[model samples]
Target: MTALHCDGSLTADRASYGGIIRDDNSVLGMELLAILRGVTLCIQKDLLRVSIRSYSKLAVDILNGIVSCPWSLQALKVRITSLMEQLQRKEIRHVWRELNQPADFVAAIDTGDGESFFYPPDFPLDLVELIKNDSDRKTYFRTPSH
Candidate 1:
């Protein structure tokens, strides 16, 4: 199974959303966008079984139909639903932000360019370290940002 972690960050100056910069200020919108992009990438890579993790409980609930999707996000909801149907198996779960640091870091990065995917050798060193720590089940603390 392929595991995908996703996140979105909104700051006073700008928003780094779903691997792209957008004028939208809604953090929820950004979270949904990140999930959409992650799922889309999974499909493109022919990953049929996937586990998607997000720190937004609302986003997870909305995607799982546990909560109603807002009217503004109906289109995105529909698209995500359609894409999910193509998967052989899937699990969408809400996790603590600490457990999702790699994705959070990626979402916070503003490259000014659109989506980016990094493979081994080309992966950012910081990200690689984070992934290694996660895989090793090492514990770390993150100070909450205002």
Candidate 2:
């Protein structure tokens, strides 16, 4: 499944953990990504002390949608809130589609004889691609050796 890290800016005291709920309309793969991300972190830190395995491409795409979910409408917010309260947690993990392109490619772009894009009733291809491309290009330019 797709796993990612996110960072947010703060002005005053501290930043709220930024977490997104996957779009429920999509497949459960996105949810799996969130779970996998947590599992991955725990394994890396040797905290939970458990074995972890990567998820399939389908799972990753689903996770991408999940990562884009707005927590305000997600039911998982309650559990997150409770856990944070008990742990004094501040940082939130999130998986965004752009950052998890491998899955996106497998599910859409890399699919054999398949379409690589979608156009919602109001969404424009150029605009969306333009924004994503612009950000990536910016990053490439800002690299230390650039």
Best by lDDT: 1
Alpha-carbon deviation at 124 in model 2, angstroms: 35
For model 2, residues 31-128, the per-residue Cα lDDT tens digits are: 45444445444545656433222233434332334434344434543343333343322333343444444334334443367334444444456456
For model 1, residues 2-113, the per-residue Cα lDDT tens digits are 2344578898998775643443226678898898888999999999899999999988999999999878888988988889999999999998887898999888778788
Compute each candidate's TM-score over C-alphas. 0.76, 0.24
Model 2 clashing residue pairs (backbone): 1-55, 21-69, 22-66, 29-63, 30-62, 30-63
Q: lDDT value for candidate 1?
A: 0.85
Pairs that collide in candidate 1 are none
Worst 10 residues of 1 by lDDT: 17-26
lDDT of 1 at 94: 95
TM-score of 1: 0.76
